[model samples]
Target chain A: MNSTIALFLLQDGVINGAIYALLGVTLVLIFAVTRVIFVPQGEFAAWGALTLASLESGATPGTALLLVVLGVSAAVVETIRERASMRPARLGVMAVRDVAMPIALLLIVSTIAPTKPALWLSVLLTLALVVPLGPLVYRLAFQPIADATVLTLFIAAIGVHFAMIGLGLIFFGAEGFRNEPFIAGVFPLGPLMFKGQSLVILAATAALLAALWFFFEHSMLGKALRATAINRLGARLVGIPTRATGRIAFALAAAIGALSGTLIGSLTTISYDSGFIISLKGFVAAIAAGLASYPVTVVAAIGVGVLESFAAFFASAYKEVIVFSLIIPLLIWRSLVTAHHDEEEE
Target chain B: MRQSIRIALLSGGVCLVGTTTLAQVNVGITVSQTGPAAALGIPQKNSVAQLPKEIAGQKVDYVVLDDATDPTKAVANARKMIAENKIDYLIGSSATPATMALVDVAAETKTPYCAMVPSKAVVDPVDEKRKWTFKAPQNDAIMAESLAEHMAANGVKSVAFLGFTDGYGQGWLEEVEKAMPAKGIKITAVERFQRTDTSVTGQVLKILASSPDAVLIAASGTVAVMPQKTIKEQGYNKPIYQTHGVGTMDFVRVGGKDVDGTVFPAGPVVVADLLPDSHPSKKVGLEYIKAYEANNKTPFAVFGAHLADCMSIAANSVKPALEKGKPGTAEFRSGLRDAIETTKELPATHGVYNYSPTDHAGLDNRSRVLIKIVNGKWTLLP
Candidate 1:
């Protein structure tokens, strides 16, 4: 009974699972609000981590906390601007206004936001950077590219993906970057549990999802966002600023991506290259449901993570094969189910 | 250029007066200089780049080509070096398959191909079937033999072997088979999988099912790190043995604390004390380590540095004969072959690389080390 091997696999699942899940959540949210899947989500993670790596080193706990506060503030502002603008808020005029700044800020902040920020501050800074991203994406990349064609939008995202990776390599250099874990050391629980910085990833993910659920379900802004997502014309007819709402969702989703990135940076040894893999996994997770939405995406990420964990334990070599092989059959099954459901409804 | 041609015409006329002119030997060096392989390529490139500088006194003209690590590309590149570049002796094709591709090209050109394949595929493919190709670098079979010795010294008996199904993995597997039996060890279990497969817990469970004294792992990159974590959590008390690929800090960091107590069989770390100052290899090994660290802007890697070392030693053997005025493909090949075999005076970073036509990998049992990963640090085993 090599419990350590089992524990290792179990812990890996939980840690990577949380990161994937949050990223999947952001992708889902953006898709939900805008009806377009965003592929640039991993850039937010890389950007957030790079931001933290720059600022999080050698700071006092108090200073770190202060950085986190400032980060949260930035995130709020970003969210408002992005989510509000997505409703085609100035009748397509402010489409430029809605998404441009957040994207620029994400790029700039991650690369040059200064180092030596406090540890807690590093994490906060990352979250703050991401908070507005979800909403921002809806306004900038999705909205403009949305009308062109699906292929164009997908291509645009792939281009963005390449651009982001190239930028990280050029700016960060092709080296694995480091960040000290916010907490160190592990507490083992019998044969099956782990307590360390990695476990904290799950806690953070839960908090993010809970926040999203609250905002989307209970808040006034949330209801407006849902209206905008359902039908821009109807929302506008009902006096909702659909354009503005879409922008805000873009900002919010972008922010979530950034926060996930930051959390990932805090927990793992990240290279600038880590983003693409994260992006790949996140993108796959988002589309886990044929249509990108939260219900299927989060489940997909968790499912993949669990599979990987089990693979790591039993056949680390075969884990990826298991993941890819599982997807093909799943897609077929999903198509069959969708067709059956459609027939039943008809 | 025209003016130099006139001078060369005059020199040729005078040289015609001098013993009907001496023969010329063409030499070629192959290394990876670009693409993903550039991680090891640049060093290989530099070794080729520096060969001419070292051959300043020799009469040999040389060519350098990039392997790029693709077997198809390597063959094309090697063929171009032979047919187009007019090189007589061929060295390198970074990976085993790449080297194997060059075997036919080398045979057609009648050029002797010497290579550095840490993977076992290079030698296993050559056997009685091919005689023109020789290996210069350490092979996985030899490495397995080394590892088997390590296991025996540590009082290990029953063991489980886990490896990827690729050439690198299978090569080590074959070598372990060769060496383990002599050590009186029984391989209780053997597990295999494709490199890209992410989960290995089932194979690990199967390996652990045998209740062996140790587990041998031969893998590289992400493939190397995943299993250590599984082994850690599954609570295996017996030491896990890894090949050279896992002997790096990447394994320790990626494996995290999960690999803290594992043992990986390796050769000398070019940066470390294994090559003492008194050893003839100290200066050359240290210099390459320094140059690679400076060029790559980092510390040393045992694998990359060893490749760099091979390039230097190969150049040393070929360069002088190339200069002795018999600078043709045949003379250069014969020269390199003779120099490599007869060169007992020079020292190699790995060991005294007295390579011969019969002994492609000129190594003995003394050429290895066992390193342990303990508390996230690489330490030599006691």
Candidate 2:
């Protein structure tokens, strides 16, 4: 390929890689904090994109209803599990956060959705609808099995993935959706045209990375999350509240996933099941980082994107095979480099 | 006591005859109701509710099952339906792999099978196993020929190909490879992408770099929009041609302005409203579309029409098949197969079927029409 074509491919790869990097970082974060593989992380992205599409089309997204349903279930599960320690104030907080909040959000969305609110409002509403779902999912699925083996948590995460996919189908139907890009122009740079949305995605990724760095390096809650990721029992001993930190990590992952979905929704057509494959690429990047280093995950995700783009160009039929096969060599190198550790006795 | 025993035997014999004449015809259906192919399967499942409840004065009981786009589950569903439901006819698994998986079971059970997918491999050559199988959708070869002819007539010399890596894509590619070469149209570039791929930019860039006169995308459903949109965004203004796999409105809806001028070969039913009254499929197509739209309260997808055509073909074959034997008998199954083979000029939504022992796809050039998306609407191309 010529320089111009190569440049175009690089630009395309970087844009996609940005999204994958965001997802990869979130996957790493969630896995580190919760000891769950978080397979349903992609589902939130799909839900975000679809919810935005529905709002644009002047219909209250079915995800609002789903949020209420999940919230109620999470509330019920949490209450029963903590019934012994539950106080009047805690019950009141649970009732408001889990039950009343979702109901109010549903009401607001249904009322404002028909008017086809502005893009920013729609996006904010989409996030509001999807972000809480992460914590709710943790409460309902993972928290119950918090002390279970990683294998069990991974299976539970897959179960949640299927459930979310099913719910996505019910909410979005089978039709795929694409949202209008936030910015609608192209910039020509040295014989290569960059789409406005691609730039937006790159900028957003950088900004999010900076925000995450600041959060972890400076913020108290972020330090607590880092501590939890380092040692759950130690963090609990230091009064960090491992459960709360886990929930916070999920919320952060959910937010990142939702934002990534919004960015991706403008770039391509997204269906209910689209997130799985996209997130799968991110998973590859995470695995390449040995599922630990965020900076390495970002770099690896970009590398994966570039590799995928080139692979598609060189061998279109084997694009997915080529991309997925990277994991094999990565695993080999990882095993060769890293020392294996036995599972810590619970 | 002897007279009473004689009377009881006589009544028993009459009751057996009564049940035999009024036996129900069980038709089992399996479709991908909740998986990747759900977009196609849901419509087919909906159309099942619109199928004829009674054919030739015999009650037709349809046992619908969800394969979830899994071929293994499709086989299991087929086996269960045959063993427990005692299905006389089987209509399957909305996708190619799942549909293909049911062929052996249909052959082994000596039952007639109807496949909703367009892959010619499902019924071509009509082997011992395939002879029992019939497909509803027009073969890829037929549509490919039409597409090649259109490209040639429009003075397109070279084309680029982009499609799914699945059977649908491979099937269309094989047909296009054959049809294009025969029309003296060269395929300059060939690319493949997965149905769930989020981006096809690299593939599109490569296709554009080849700079052919046209690009032909062989993907189906909403996924088809990705390559077209990516190509368009890259500023490739050449004519983009799609296959009948994208006949549904969802393709147009998802592709939007990028797909506006896209030329594709689709079933006549997709543009039934635009077809002249003289067209054989026009009346039936309109009728089916009306019934489906009224029931579903949405625009009728062309995929559903395939199942409707299958139902009509089966319904048309029932009368002659019933003349041979009872509904649940093997004689009836073979009779139905033979009758389906002899089907002639039977108009359905997609086309007029004329099946024969040598040809199980049962469609012709008349089954396909050239369509263009104009202003986000499907317009029949003259």
Candidate 3:
């Protein structure tokens, strides 16, 4: 409650808020484009974290070079998948090829230069579905329910939750592993103490945000994607590959989620159940922002994270009480505000 | 040969019917096994369940009930274990709430209860610790004192405390707080959290803002892990301290690498990583790990392994009474207490146990040591 307490909480809030923003952005992107929530995004983070220690010591520095080569192979694989999908008679082949690309890319690239081979290998097995399975989800699950209520999309998301939990257990195993501190140095400036890891997280988050802003402001693809986000029918009518834009956004968000997961894992210990906790936090952030607005969701995610950290700090005898208390009130408040806004719009 | 042995046992039993048939006593134990706190409660349950099996020659029936970390359910189950099951002796009463509930029943029925609750109230029960009541491990005061001593030894001058605002955390934190000033350690910031909290950021940031030399989180089990994670994530790079409650197996799994450099005040068994090869305690720990893993088909928790050893001593106390003649409940209780005290060198899996009536737990001040998590493994720093 004092300045000392408030200052650190704010700093913590900013870090937490930024991470939440990244996650919320990912969730919103997939929900809008694919009509699937990609409930397994948090698990991808957990897997990335579990593999960080190995990556620190063992991954080949040549992976960046290898990725360039693999990108061409991946582009070719996608062309083949597109061809198969066009043939109504061989629809199953397209499905198979679509599901094979992400896994294939991870395996082929990782095998050649994996630093922490075992950990990265395990993570790849858990998360390779990030790309290839999106279309299959669209064709098999979402296509049937595309015309259903918004409530139905939410329900399918809940089902995604169960499947992701099972996938985490099946791939990464249920045991928790320790995440070594990514930062090793600390310096104090009078009243303020700083951890190198915290600095890295903050700095990296800032850089990512700046880069994203530039991409959206100056780049052709980013502008086209934004246009696609605004009006899908108009974008398609104007010769924009709206579907392709959606695919790129989905892939980028997933890769960002992968980055977040690796950073989290690098920073803490993790287990298969890490995603359940993530889902709870991310969903709250999404809802608090009305699940539509960009800046609001980011701000809400970080604010909630800081509040959550404080809740965890305070009543640890029942640490969960703090979390529920903080989020439930915000949710109720948001509902009231949203209702009032809807009445005004009407 | 088997038919002949059965006929021999029938004849011997008939001859000793007046003596043996009146004795086969039953002891009841109730603890959690499957809930959130089951991480700690399960070990106690396993230790209690294994008692009869370990002491094979004794004709004792052990009745164990799983409360699964629910206090109301635990109290209900305790009542069933007593009133319905009609156990002759009661050995467990694991958590503070559960043990407190059972104390009322034990006092009413005048049942001798060997306490497993890790609170000061267990020693000085509300109506005063009955002559029938005995404890097998260190109480809150000892853990507090040991923790202070451990912190002092490492040159930790200032500390921040984050504890649950409940009986267990409050009770132990008070004892540790009172002892800290004398040890030259200052408490800079104090924060309270419910045991079920999911984020400890506010309190952790508060502590981080204080920038104290160290932090001690006096909460138990899984509840202790989250704040530890968030604190480090925000990059609070000070030594985090924990009392007896947080320094066990489950917290390690929860906190992961965030717990590295976090220190816990614990029994000698926890800091076994520091024991020299020549140390007898080291040998005991090694043997216990081997024997326990072999018997249970799972890795052993330090607390659970210690609990099993304590029970072995308790059961050994009644061996002579069982052999000389079948002894009743009171006789076994007193004999067990005496048996625990009489062992000059326990040759236990932990260390040589030495106890007296005044020291019911059989652990000395030397029993507590400072253990730190470095990277992913437990090690003794000093």
Candidate 4:
């Protein structure tokens, strides 16, 4: 291929890689803290993008109703599980945060969505609608089984993934939606032109990465989360509130997923079932890093994106096969390189 | 009081006697209602509400099931319907693979089957298995011929090909290969992508590198927008041709301005209002569109028209078949098959059908019309 075409493909790869990197990082964080593979991470992104599209079209997004339903279910599940230790103040807090907050958000969105609010307001509302779904899902599906084996948690994540996909279909309908770009236009860079939205995605990814680094290196909660990721029992023994840390990890993952959805939604169509493939790509990146190192996951995600683009250029029919197959070699390498350890002994 | 009780008893007895003699015709329908093909199947399911409750003086019973786009489930559904429901007619499984799965069951049960998919393999060569099968959509070859003719007329010499990797894409690719070559057009590039692919920039780049005079996208539904949009974004502004699979309003809605100039061959029903009064399908197409929109409380999707046409063909055959035997009897099913095969000059939503023993698809060149998307609306091309 000519250099110009190669550069164009590179630009496309990097843009896609930015979104995949965000998802990969989230996958690592969630896996580390919760021991869950987070299969439903892409659903959150799909919900975010579809929700934004709904708002932009002056319709009340179904996610608002979903939030309320999930919130009520989470509150009920948490209350029944913690009944023995529940206090009156804790009950009040649960009632307000779990039940009241979603209803309030629903009311506000219902009021402004039909008015076709500004793009920024619609995006803010989308985040408000989708981000809480993460912790709510955690509270309802994973909290009771927090100490379960990784396989059990992974199975539960898959169940949640299917449930969310079904719910996504009901909420968004079967038609695919593409949102207007947050930014429009293109910038000429030597032989190649960069789309404005692609630049936005790159800038956003870098900013999010820097912010995450700051949070982990400087913030107390981040250190607590890191401690929990290192040793859940040890963190709990040191009064770290492991359940809270799990919720925090989920919330961050959801935020990242939602942001990625908004970024990529403009680049391609977003359907109810579109999230699985996107997140699967991210999973490939996480696996490439052995699900441990954040920097490695990000860098590997970009590499995966570049490889996928070139594969598509060369063999479009086998693009997916090639992309997913990379994980096999990476897995073999990881197995040979890393020393084996028994988790039960730990 | 005694007289009134006697009169009620007499009427109840008459009703019971009448119910025993009333003919009942059962039809089984299976479509992908909740999976990847739901966009196509949901409309077909919705069109079921428009089907006649009674046909040819018989009570028509419809048993609709969702296959979820799984071929295994489609087979199971077909077997269950045949065994339990004792349906004489079968229509279903909106996609090709699932629809093809039902063919064996249809042949084994000797049921008259109507498929909504466009693949010619569903019924061709009049094999023993396919004798019981028929389809509503225009065959891919017919539509491909229309597209190739349009390209040739416009002075296009070479074209790039992009389509799905599934049966639909491969089927179209084969047709395009045959049609384009006959029209003396060269295919410069061939690329395939999944329906769920998030990007086609790489494929678009490859197509651009080859730099054909035109592009033909053989995908259906909302996914068809991706390659066109990518190609446009790359500043390649040559003519682009799409297949009939993208005749849905959702395609126009999703593609928006990017698909403004897209030209494709579609069922005449899509542009029913614009079709001339002399057109054979205009009246029937408009009526179906009106009824569908009113019943579904949404704009009529072109996919739904396929099912409506199937129902029309079934309705026409049922009248003559009743002369042979009872509705549930094997004699009646064989008679129905013969009647469908003998169907002549029957106009439905999509087009007029003239099915024969050798041709179960029944649609001709009149079924297809070249349509261009202009300002988010379908305009009939002269």
**DockQ numbers for every candidate?**
0.15, 0.65, 0.18, 0.64
Q: On residues A49-112, what C-alpha lDDT tens digit does candidate 3 reach at each position? A: 5444334444432222223333444444545657655566445443345434444655664564
Which candidate would rank higher by DockQ, 2 or 3? Answer: 2
- Residue-by-residue lDDT tens digits, candidate 4, A1-346: 8888788878888888888899999999999999999999999889989999999899999999999999998888888888999999998998999899999999999999989998888888899998898999998899899988888999999999989988998889999899889888888889888888888999999999999999988999999999999999999999999999999999999889988998888888899999998989999999999888999999999998888888889999999999998989999999999998766454
Worst 10 residues of 2 chain B by lDDT: B11-20
lDDT of 1 by residue, A213-254 (tens): 899899999998887766656888989976667677767765
State the C-alpha lDDT per candidate: 0.62, 0.89, 0.60, 0.90
**Lowest lDDT block of 10, candidate 3 chain A:** A60-69
lDDT of 1 by residue, B1-382 (tens): 5996576456434433332354433456676654334445555555543333334354444555665567887887677666554565677766667777777777677666767667545544444434456665566666787778788888999888888777777777778887899889999987875543334556777788789999988876534766665566567878788887665565565566667777776666432565456655567666766666666565555556555555555566665656543544466665665676554544666655665546656665435666777687777664
lDDT of 2 by residue, A1-346 (tens): 9888888778888888899999999999998998899888888898899999999989999889999999898888888998999899988998999999999999999999999999999999999999998899898998878888989999999999999999898888998999989999889888999888998999999999999999999999999999998888899999999889889999998999988999999788889999999999999999999889999999999999999888988999999999999999999999999999866556
Q: Judging by DockQ, tell me the better candidate of 1 and 2.
A: 2
When 1 and 4 are scored with TM-score, the better candidate is 4
Stretches > 4 Å off in candidate 4: A82-85, A344-346, B1-22
Please give the TM-score of chain B in predicted model 2: 0.93
lDDT of 4 by residue, B141-180 (tens): 9999999999999999999999998888999999999999
